[model samples]
Target: MNKSIETMWKQGFISEGELVVPKVNDLYNRKSQNLVDKLQHMFAVNIKAIVIGALLLLVVMSLIGAPWLGIYICILLAPLVLMARQELDKSYNLSKGQSSLEYLESFNAWLHDSITRYAIYYKFFYPLFYVGMVSQGLASDAGTRVMARLLKTYPTDYVFLDIPGYVWALITVLLLVVIKYSAALYRLDLNMIYGRQFKKLEELIKDMRALKPE
Candidate 1:
């Protein structure tokens, strides 16, 4: 390992979940700055495309004053939402009793759930945890476009808007789906290994506690 990555690993800088501090020398950090710098490029290529596409459809509807598309947009994203939910459920199921995070003794002792010790945290984080530093601006324009498509009531004119917003919106949604899907699978694999380890620890402790006084 390079000295920087070595130091980061030694310091336990790589971690998961809501605690999403970026580690030094990580791919998102100094070690691969060039790669991380393309995060916006990825978003522009992926998310922005689809969001814009969806908005364009709405715009097309507006130019003709069509009413069908209002309800269509409502249902248009249903499949994506369903797929996202399926991805999340799969991760939660696969991550049962795995360790994705841990705090010191006192920090955890206060938690009431036995599974919260280390294992269940895997499930908690398996859905939305950032693996490395986030690809900042990866989906920045998605939210704005989604809201605009949903709430805006402006007149639609195709001539001024040469660019394809509907395509951008569709690409954005697909990118989010793919990213979440991959992370879910990665989390599932990690939790499966750690889940077994936790089970073994439980068995070992039970055996030791049952031993007769010597």
Candidate 2:
């Protein structure tokens, strides 16, 4: 039994003369274990999803004659898989013998640090992903035809990096827009996936803290 939970029991959460409350203690233990278990499960699932998604993207891109772009996407996603694995390992290796409160605190700290690091990675990732997709599309046969049509109708006298100035400007603006909002986008994504679990963890920690001695 965790010391914090033991303390909680001693502090009147259970009967006055009783040393233990099977029902209450079990409830807290179950909740704590459940939260940690869910987090680990989610991490495992996320890694699998990324791998499957990457493989599917590679296959689809190959069929569409953009194998390089597919490979590039996989390369971009590789770090994410590695990061997730690191997080999963960390979660598994949380300090032994910690009180429930201390354990939760440790997990919370890990979560915060992981999110901060991912925020930085996403700043570059979102923009790069956008650029890769756009560039790949433009290099495709249909995009080539469209570009030819545009160049024919509009003068190509001014060019940048072999692209018509106007087209290049549009791409640049879009890329900048994606980069500007990448952090927010990452937050939104993170929340969508883990918001419920995060909330539960925080609430559990708060409840545990309230039970501590003054």
Candidate 3:
């Protein structure tokens, strides 16, 4: 119908030649931009949180004579923060000047890959971070005080293991348990952090996929 054709054209849904679906493209582009903005904002907020947390940790470590643990936290998370920045840059770059369904597909793939890598890296390092923190603390004056109190309370002879030894055993068991369930735990954590935003992206991608260019 001529009327329908004219309406489609007016809506920027169809074109005469190679099908330049401007409406669809523009919609996707706006969504991509929104996602990029969210990522940038999230990155900024995460960096701030990391800095604040690091400072607090450093203060605590200093008070407890376990400065190395604070340093370890900074060292571990610094690279991750940088990686997030790089990923954000890549996302923005991918979204630039391109708003087709193909672009949406590529962005979807990129997001999935980036998130997978992030989860992998996070799971790998999370236990190490905890181990370093605990190890450093256990070697500090604070640890000695805690050990003394624990020994006084529990009195090693009961269990045939000293307080510190029992603590080490407990830490080892915890490490094993965490390592075993790290993947699932990381997934839950990621879902908590990015679930809503990721769902939006998925929905946009699905919508774009359904739009067939003529």
Candidate 4:
């Protein structure tokens, strides 16, 4: 551990306690960090997929006109959706790792603080970030459809229903479901870990009472 981190822990900057549970680490205690890292990777992959797929579809649609773009869009969308599912696996593996030492504390206090910290960084930040990505696709789809109508490739009054195109979008929705379910399962595991970490935290609190801040 970094000496600064140790000093902060000692000073109650990170938390007020002695973290006595070392190598016998809990998986739940370290999940949020791993989840953050995996999401970073997934976002990178999504960018590459979006750019490459959109560019390819745009070029093909310009040549063949609108109806064909739907097929082309589907082809491109497949990878984006499939890779997103793959992201869930990455998060799953990330959630399984061990930490060096976890600050043991009361379940109410620790769980509340940890969840609050993570909700700020993960739920708020990540959703805002990913929402921007979904918006990009929606914009691209709208732009393409509108252009197709302008070029006389699509009927002006025709209600657009790209069966294959939506398949790709549906896949993304499915991947999100998988990610959510995995997160829920991980949370269940975390509740169990909270019980153990809380016991360890009580022990550490007792230990702290026996030591001075020398």
Candidate 5:
């Protein structure tokens, strides 16, 4: 044990004669690998989900006669899905023969960057998602007929300003609801994608940082 500690000290992973913060051992390495593997699994799941979601969205839009909108959404989401797969692949190709601390540090940096980029991408992408779905639904055959009837029936009832009263009122209300909840939706989406694994990685990183040699 003393010899291993001395060797680790010489390797710059610990301070001379100081206690290791996370107690460097096989257990530590295993835990790190487990956490990282879990994250990779999540990325894999997300890739599949994205593909499935794209297909479903395309089918829905095509049924509604808005195949173009569905195609557009797939195009927008493709990059995000690709990005995630790329990151996961990169993580799996981690450096061989690295010390546990070095491995964790490298993983930490990659995980941090990956999480930030994914969050940013989703924040921008989701609003577009919301808009595409809503607008496409409204442009569908049934939707158009409903709007036509509403306008025909209540031609003079202005909901607000120059907009028709009942129709515009409904539109205005839906729009406001979407706008009000956009931030919350983004948070929810991100949490669903990266929350648990992200927090685990964060806690591991924190523990590793605490153990860093002074």
Candidate 6:
């Protein structure tokens, strides 16, 4: 429905006497707009889900007497909210004067940049989040009681900072592995969440590109 796309459609009809080219162009234009709209809707839903999920977790954590853990997780998640807002603003501000193909391409580029940016954050965030959860759990009252029992059962030589040295070693190894694969893990998560939309977007872009006039 973009004015530029409308103009392109008119031009295509004028240049080519056959209706096939124009009709195909029109079909792709509609598909492109629909796909973009769907993507925007999905993005908004994802943001809402994050906020709702965070609030629910906060409530659960408070009820469980680990409100600080919930607060820490929310703090960690704050940047994600800002990032999504920035990306959503960018999506809204994408130039409307361009043709459908250009618009879709711009969105596709934005998607890639968004994913890369998130991936970079994930590399650090995943590890920090794990560490936060573990550290917070070990600092809680329940953790103190558990640690006390462990101390009574195990030799002090095998304990470090009230936790078994082996547990610390395992945590360290897990953190290292998470940091190394965090981006890949994020991609997998994203794929699981939006795999169908992603595939459709790719196919739409491919079709639009093929239909583009030389």
CA lDDT of 149 in candidate 1?
59
Every model's TM-score: 0.22, 0.85, 0.72, 0.26, 0.68, 0.86
Candidate 1 global CA lDDT score: 0.37
TM-score preference between candidates 1 and 3, better one: 3
- Across residues 1-214, which tens digit of lDDT does each residue of candidate 6 receive? 2454445444442223222386676667667666777778788889988888999999999999889889988888889988998887788777766566666778889999999999998887898899889888789988888888877787567777878886778789988999899999999999998889989988887876665556
CA error at residue 164 for candidate 3, angstroms: 4.7
lDDT of 2 by residue, 1-214 (tens): 2353345434534332221445655566568777877787887989999999999999999998999999999999999889888877877677746556677798899989989888999999999999899988888888888887888889778865456889988999999999999999999999999999999999988876766556
lDDT of 1 by residue, 68-87 (tens): 54335534444444443443
Candidate 6, run of 10 with poorest lDDT: 11-20
Runs in model 1 lying further than 4 Å from the true structure? 1-33, 78-214
Better of 2 and 5 by TM-score: 2
Runs in model 2 lying further than 4 Å from the true structure: 1-23
CA RMSD per model (angstroms): 19.2, 4.9, 7.5, 13.6, 6.5, 3.6
Report the lDDT of model 2 for residue 174: 92
Clashing pairs in 2: none
Taking all chains together, the TM-score of candidate 3 against the true structure is 0.72
Q: How many backbone clashes does candidate 1 have?
A: 22
By TM-score, the candidates rank as 6, 2, 3, 5, 4, 1
What is candidate 3's lDDT per residue for 174-198, written digit by digit as tens? Answer: 9888777777787897789878887
Assess candidate 4 and give its lDDT: 0.43
Q: For model 5, where is the 10-residue window of minimal lDDT?
A: 1-10
Report the lDDT tens digits of candidate 5 across residue range 123-195. Answer: 6676677677666666677767766676777677554433356665565576667666665776787788778
Instruction: Give me the displacement of residue 87 in model 1, in angstroms.
Output: 8.5
Q: Order of candidates by lDDT, top first?
A: 2, 6, 5, 3, 4, 1
